[model samples]
Target: MKVLLILADGMRPDSLTNIPQAQKLIKESAYTLSGETVSPSVTLPCHISLFHSVTPQRHGTTTNTYAPQVRPINGLCEVLKQADKKCAIFYNWEEIRDVSRPNSLAHSCFYAGRRIGYKEAGEALTADAIGYLKKYDTDFTFIYFGYPDWAGHKYGWMTEEYLQAIQSSWDNIEKLMAELGDEYTYIITADHGGHDRTHGSDMPEDMVIPVIIKGKGFDAGKILENVNIMDIAPTVTKILGVTPDEEWEGRALI
Candidate 1:
């Protein structure tokens, strides 16, 4: 089965309020609102863990800057590429480009969110992802929406503007779901949550995230427990019938 992973950066589980698409997703997917992200809870580090299935210490990316792994462990896309899967990425954050090694992706698209604004960037990205996924047969795809994090940082986390950002993100998600249907195993989550205008702390406000898994094998409305952002890659590889990287520390969720 094809896998589609969508991440809304800096979205707290409490921040899912009043979003129509998010409620629909939660109602239709097996989800956990208490999923934990790695310490530091920064964007690039948490995402590295999500893709590599390891913590910040193991990946050595404890901040927004990318750090080459001490002993390189194959990331999700690399492992999928070795399995002959066609992988693609659509994102607005440029730093996240290092999530996978070179030559692992079949296609990659980036929108300059910092320059053109993340909301506009996300619109262009979501449209491109939907169009590309429909026209071609892609085995694995990852789409990142950086607007929420931007809003959280610009305004304050959980503020009206931040909530609006979350709502706007789900609006894009709704559009994708409507256009693509449910052919893919969908994994929706966040990189990390924020408190006030910043994150990177070890507090629950920064560490707790939400994970939603919607697919054939998952039971809708089932409340999951003990979920982690790191588990996403393993679950995706398992769903796609590909092998998880040998060095991955996260377990595949049932």
Candidate 2:
């Protein structure tokens, strides 16, 4: 089976301590990396860096307003599909509104309804993810959870609301992972870290996010330093016995 990547948008390194479930998860099967994100930590550009394995400036998506373009760079989904493996995305963002893109990425794509804020929108996203859990038979799944980041961006990572939101998201993720069991390797990461409710800057707090991996397939009990967010795509494809595109700037962590 391929890996399952859960991307929590706008999540911070400090927020990791608040979620007991995630903390326990880290203690168990965690191969955590202290990852640095590309500049412009907002959703669209950050996601571009994540998928394309390049800096936001190189990827030409330096802001939320830019339409996603994937030329001169290929993402994990493209690599997986070319290798004859199944890939799917349960996305809740507008950048992927183009139906053709998701269809090309996966055999099936599930775009759940969107919401305004993190908590308000995530309940629907979680349920949508749970439903997709039961239906999809794909080898790889990418689920995006966007509350902690929302709270973090609006209320700061150290605030009570952000902590609570982080915990809640982790609780939901635990349920999903428990149900899936060892059928898939789970990789949880954030696009970027933030502080004082802002990203898109070169600050340490905004650049470093946590990369948590679990499941029997993972090495476990490992810590990586100075990792790059772009590295995840290559690492995931490598685990599935596939080669990443030449344009990708990451190397396999495994």
lDDT values for all models = 0.93, 0.72
Per-residue error for 185 in candidate 1, Å, reads 0.9
Show how many residue pairs clash in every candidate, following the order shown.
0, 1
RMSD of each: 0.7, 2.6
- For model 2, the stretches where C-alpha displacement exceeds 4 angstroms are 67-71, 96-102, 107-117
- Writing each residue's lDDT as its tens digit, candidate 1 over 66-135 gives 9888888999999999999999999999998999999999999999999999999999999999999999
TM-score of 1: 0.99
What are the models' TM-scores? 0.99, 0.89
45-84 per-residue lDDT for model 2 (tens digits): 7777777787777778777776556555666676777888
Model 2 TM-score on a 0 to 1 scale: 0.89
Candidate 1 versus truth, CA RMSD in Å, comes to: 0.7
Worst 10 residues of 1 by lDDT: 16-25
| lDDT agreement of model 2 with the native | 0.72
